[model samples]
Target: MELVSEHVANWTGVRLFQQALRAAGGHRFPALPAALPDANGGSLPADRAAVVLAELDAFAGTARITDEVELIDEATGRVLMQYVESYRGVFMFGPGFQAGVHPEGFFVLDRADPPVTLFRAARFGQRALPGDRVEFTVGGTRTVVAMRPVGEHGEPPPERLAVRTRSRSGGDFAYVVEPLRRLCAASVATGNPVMWC
Candidate 1:
């Protein structure tokens, strides 16, 4: 399915969050895996589903407390659970967990039969500011440039932008890179053009 959003999104995280959205609205996502490993080195098929569902309900209720979702560490056979304060509709899953959606900045993905992927380090000659963004397009044969903010420069950034900046400044650049990397990898794996704007 084509996932459309005006904000930055992780491919898998967005899909999972979409499922949670549906579940929070009183619908179950049967597409969820039939089973997920638990911290006890034992699989908890039923409990996993229950925990996810319950958490969705709680999220919908705007509850402050988050119950632990028993999931096993993929690399280490240990329990992993934690809560992250959400910002800009982005709910960051705790460490070692890969199931949360973050919406920040903006990028549009245009699908192409065979996408072109490019990776290059930013070349800064001392003029590059922290707020400067690198414009990139993933799938298209042509370049795309985004327009600057319409308002005056002194104005504060939008809340979403502020949150995103905080996230990046807090050494969470990996969170942003991980999603983009996943998108690029997906394009490479599927032989499809993944456009970014």
Candidate 2:
């Protein structure tokens, strides 16, 4: 059987393929890489769920993968590799794979860009902003693993706080501003890095 389109339109393979391809060399097809384990049992590394998709702009003989790329035919249960046209050049799905060919860590999602929901935020019915970096897990079909924001360290966003500046005598200091208060509103100090009150 042949699919005229060269694009493998699925998420299962794209997330896994890119990783293996990069590590194993560009031309060499990589065996599916195992998903790294996280707190939620085991899921794809939240940091590396790259949606490698491009517009099907003016091109030929290569179709862009909009979502996931699968190796097996769901109906026939046969491994498949379809060559189709895409924006990035020839995109081949597979030469047909075995049942167990699926690589671990391939998290399936309904949409390419999953909603950003930190464990803490999800509890409050809040999602991450469009540009906020988030990671997640996929528990089942079209299931989303509530995303976990990444690259975040040290106390959550700052609020009200009290501080004291170093003072010796009754000095007529022009102003005193606490740098630790990230939310503190202060004007720039005339000569010092200190924010003038």
Candidate 3:
């Protein structure tokens, strides 16, 4: 993410005033510079001024609060819990990808045969941040298997297991079939080549 110093001048001015107050032998108190616009017209409300003073008193350079959570590991089926203080952004992958967020972290899996690609869904709502480790239940019960490919030689070869040949009026169209084992034979055409080892 790009960092823009939108409020840097304002914050710097506040810090300078606080420093001057400390150097003046007075109790260190936060002071608003005259240039800063008051939340209430030209004057700050008593309650708002008090809150600002309290915030300055409590400010200890560069301190921030953080929170923790749990995530899961898809490969080992392990549960990993960790802290995630902020949401940076998300990494996007194309559609139909199934991924899980565990205490170990978030990861996309390749359920297709030969594991075509490791991808994360484009829209996974409020799941987890990049660094956060969380635990989640694996959804969807269906399992896919690898189908042997019939090669041009009419033999199933291991190397050709991912390759399928289809006969068309335009001649033969060759395609590398996705490895989804549970699909019925009717779903696949016979002339389609499967190079099975």
Candidate 4:
């Protein structure tokens, strides 16, 4: 099944991925190193569910996990990731900010100044203002371009103007913003690098 644009075979892979993120909590960026367990054949650690549960409790904020059982299911990770994107108005590489060819890879949008700036703001604990701007090279000349108010009246926030909400069969998924915000906060608080699996 496809979760947030990536394909995963079963909920086992989702559980394993969540465990990896929890294990890498407080880890630094560009150095979030962890080995992924095989989705089909690999088994999770005996205490992994507890660890993830604790992590969720620690970072739950206002966005409580409506269904704890979903934590072990692939839909939870995918839904959470979608909420993060919808709330933050940014496109994550895979799940969160980290992106790679495989689920384990992490990346940053270095080429674009505005995205990098906004990413830094969300990664840290700053708000990206609507008046933000950065220098961009056009044709050969560098010009200052506006970064904020990206959408009409800035309704969709920053980089999320282009995000198309997915259609779930059971109406729309109930998504809250606090969970995603707190997830970013938890990452900064623990220095645990966030990634998408």
Candidate 5:
């Protein structure tokens, strides 16, 4: 999930790349990076070992090429349809849409027994950021929700919610406070506890 150097990897991602290359016509490209040899230099190095990272760095340029790419099943060599790439780095198949390419809408259902859901935001045109309370009604499939802003010093925030502290950093452990019975816990670092107490 994390991108680290193949040379420093506990297991080489080179194996995956090699498999992908084989599926993409290995010898056709001619710029494939050579795999690192083992101590015996007889075969491809172990998959569970770090690889020579420079070898991988060498392939970056060629991999970006928009050559006719098809994801094929290795065992059967069956080319999977709808997994084709038309232009460089753009997918014309699969879900037909890429994530994070467009902004995502988020929802938080507070004061309600259930939680908020957003199958599609355009259904309601709801706009909300994190730490925001939205009041909305759920449609049959796509939920329609709206944010209910809290009045500062005028009224309490929506139930089951508390005012965030100055620092939004996490603590060592995670716990929840009761909306009705919660206590104010503000710890100040001072030499004399009695002074602030």
Candidate 6:
């Protein structure tokens, strides 16, 4: 019974193969043809074969296939890579955002080891946004060519809240607006008048 089932499956596969050959042309060979026959019977469907071949073929012609890679930090689960091609168009967050304007459209490359953000410039268009899934190249170092917004736009929260500081010296001592966070305070100049204070 097992052998019979195996034979049945094999027959089904052969039938499918015959159907594919008939679809490509009309003739079917007795045994699986070494290669698909061409319209002129010179070689298998070069065009169709080219579509299936995987290894880099220098002779057939240049084909562009976009893909993605996840950039993850080995030390931390924190996603260090963004704009991976495999993710489709979703953008991943990196340890830090690039200060410069992201190019119009390009995929974000994520590195696995030691985690790094690299941008691919030429392969993008204007459709990519921050946090979008995108396909990109894996070879060579990646560089940012363009970028798109990742999610809905919203006002960023203030880094610090203003507070009143009193000078010990004397006088009425007008209320000084001090930042809630030391880092925020550093960004404010000493003399800048704080409206909230």
lDDT of 5 by residue, 123-144 (tens): 1222233554334333443332
Model 4 residue runs over 4 Å out of place are: 1-38, 62-197
Q: What's the CA RMSD for each of the models?
A: 19.8, 27.2, 28.9, 16.4, 23.4, 31.7
Writing each residue's lDDT as its tens digit, candidate 4 over 114-153 gives: 4353122111111244466433232344334344322224
| Model 3 weakest lDDT span, ten residues long | 169-178
TM-score of each: 0.18, 0.15, 0.19, 0.21, 0.19, 0.16
Model 3 clash tally, residue pairs: 30
Q: Which stretches of candidate 1 lie over 4 Å from their true place?
A: 1-44, 63-197
lDDT of 3 by residue, 1-197 (tens): 21111222233233333333343323332343332342323433344444433433343221331122224233332323222222211122234443433223444554566545342221121222234322222343222312111111343221201111111210110010111111112123222221211
**Colliding residue pairs in candidate 4:** 26-191, 26-192, 95-196
Instruction: Name the runs in model 5 displaced over 4 angstroms.
Output: 1-50, 63-117, 121-125, 129-131, 135-142, 145-197
Q: How accurate locally is residue 60 in candidate 5, as Cα lDDT from 0 to 100?
A: 37
Each candidate's clash count: 3, 18, 30, 3, 4, 28
Q: Write the per-residue lDDT of candidate 1 for residues 79-190, one digit (tens) a residue.
A: 2222132322223222222122123222222223452222211110111124432233333332322222211146432211111211111122234334434444444455
Better of 1 and 5 by TM-score: 5
User: How accurate locally, in lDDT, is each candidate?
Assistant: 0.30, 0.22, 0.27, 0.29, 0.26, 0.27
Off by over 4 Å in 2: 1-3, 26-197
> On lDDT, who's better, 3 or 5?
3
Clashes counted in candidate 4 amount to: 3
lDDT of 2 by residue, 1-197 (tens): 21111222234334333432343343332212232221223322212222111111111112331232223322333323221112111221212211111122122122224422112111111123444422332232122233332212342311111111121211111011011111111111111121111
Residue 2, model 3: lDDT of: 16
Q: If both were scored by lDDT, which would come out higher, candidate 2 or candidate 4? A: 4
